[model samples]
Target: MRQLLKFELYKIYRQKSIYILFGVLMLIISLGLYMDRESEQANYLVYKQWEGEITADKLAYLDKEIIEIEKKMESGIETPQERLLYGISESFAYQLGNAHKHEKRIADLTAIINTDSTSYKERAAELEKNMLSKINMSKFYYDAGPAQIIDMIYTFGFVITAFLIIIGIAPILSNEYSSGMDQFLLSSKYGRSKAITSKIIASVIFTLSVITGWVALNTAVSVYTYGFHGWKAPLQSMFQHYFAPYPITLGEAYPIMISMHLLAALGFTLIVICVSAICKRGLLSLLVSGFIFGVPFAIDVVFEDLENIVWLNKLLKLSIYQCMKVKEQFVDFSTYNVFGFPVLYPVVTVLLSVITAIIFSYLTKWIMKRKQVTI
Candidate 1:
């Protein structure tokens, strides 16, 4: 097993694809850092301009808005739909209160309100209600200008790492068959079982090494660019338009987020490897893996607004994003209630993805044993 693992590692090292993937990941991180630097400078300029004039006045005005919205909602004249709409609007408004003065709070708020066509009076009322709810719900008001950009970069790493792992492992079994190496190995004394185990182990090691490399690169870039001060802030608080029912500081949420992300990457890589083993063609495996991963994203981009399609939403929800928690960074809000426990979205997502990967891998092994190789 160790010998096989070493051979696998050597193969990975010799592959130019590995270095190319690493270079791509580094390029992405560098671009993200550059963008974050520019964003920070811009944010600092805005902060200096609004240092006093806007800060105090904005907070006070937010407080008044919250009070007014609560007062109106307490009147109990609104329907459940109205109340829900109010809630959504309020969440956005609260984010605005915490937003830096130069963050285009008013324009964003107006855009949210204008998204739906309603009577002028209704629009005005909805805007007011939303503003208040947002102010009241906002638990943190710190600038995330550069930090957010960094998180986005890390999030993209999830995709890149998974892609690289597939590229690395997809050819492991397939190339052996294509090059007639499988017949030589299979003809050996321990060929059937031990050889397969060794291949599986090697694939796993290669996948994990790639994952680790990406994570290490992301960590180095993040620490260098953003420092590590606010990692404890609630992951939920980083969102701009949605609010968690319970306040969570980034300090409280980041560790779990990171853990879930790692699990997701592992699970996704395992599934891709299994696909490669079954297909036994690198290009074909790559295409299949890409489809399995990319189709969900394509659906999300095209049909995200069709909220009435509950089944579609559920299906898309099961996509790679669910496993990787990538959507958490983009979506403003997510509800979590399972068996009366307030499960975090990322935890549930990783759990489900890992479970699916295990099932698929076992099935792949079974199928491989049953199918007779022609060579």
Candidate 2:
């Protein structure tokens, strides 16, 4: 078994497709890092610059700074520093206003969760309870760097996983027949269970390695380039403003979101291998995976109104694209009930991945067992 596993791994890693996948993933990491840097400079650099010594107690600090700039303008002249400050006054004001608005939202949500816990029906009540668990209800300092960038990188990182898995693992079963190796493979003494098991194991390792390397490289490079200053900050401080109610910080959300994506990739790999086993054609498997993964975004673009259909929307949201989007997991207006308990979207995504992986694994095993030496 160990020898067979090593042989399978050797074959997968020896393939030129693996190197191509790595090159593409590294390219994405480079591009995403560059974009995050540019985005930070354009969007949040001003807010971060003006956030000096500001806090909940110093909520009026930005207002005072604005006043100082206004008083300087009263002199009917401006220096370069004053001109810069004046130009950025509205943006600075907006960040301050956003901070105050965030505090208000936290307070309101906390009150509703505590006082009105029982005022709703099944899903809503479950959602409230779930939200309550996440609400820390404490005043937090504003952090204006990296949160938005990290969110963008985490999501964009999904593309690497999905694309690379297709290229690397789509041939797990398909190429055996394509190269006329299926007959010799299945008729061997260790053919039946051992061959299928080794293939499955090989695909699992390859998919996980690609996902991990992509995430680790993306996060490491981005954080190193941008500096990890915002990990301790509240999620609400993010540009999305959608995840504000969740009590998790960027630090907590980062791993959880990445885990969801990794599990999603696993689920995708399993299904693709199953398709490969059935069709025994790598290119066809790639197309099928592409269609399955791409369908959600296509729906979102082509039929925006279809999301309004409750069951259909919930079903669509389970796809790898929807599940990979951490922002939508929290902010999107969808709730799923599991065993009568309302599970958060991200949690639901992970659970669905696990379920899908299990079911597909069984189906793949059955298919392989029933597979004849058809070359």
Task: Tell me the lDDT of candidate 1.
Answer: 0.58
- In model 1, the Cα lDDT at residue 261 comes to 65
CA lDDT of every candidate: 0.58, 0.68
Residue-pair clash count for candidate 1? 13
Write one digit per residue (lDDT tens) for candidate 1, span 1-375.
678668767876688987887797778666755546555444444333322222445566555655666677799665544444344345345455455431354455566666755454335434444543443223333335324533642457567766777777767667766787767655647655666667667766776676677667666665555454444333444554244322345544445456666667667766776786677667888888878777876776687584689888766666665566454532443434565434445456767768976876676566556656564
Shift of residue 208 alpha carbon in model 1, Å = 3.0
For model 2, the superposed segments whose C-alpha errors exceed 4 Å read 35-57, 67-123, 126-149, 152-154, 241-244, 304-306, 309-311, 332-334
Instruction: Estimate, for each residue in 1-375, the C-alpha lDDT of model 2 and write its tens digit.
Output: 888899889878888977876887688657745645565444445445654433544446545666777777899666655655564555444545655655565566566666664444344544554554554423333344356455654466667777777778778788988998888777878867898888889989998898777667766766655556656665655667443446677777777777777787788888888888887688988888788778776786687687579787767777767765545776633455556555566667788889988989889889878877664
**Model 1, 122: alpha-carbon shift in Å?**
31
| Error of model 2, residue 328, in angstroms | 1.8
* Backbone collisions counted per model: 13, 0
RMSD of each: 12.5, 4.6
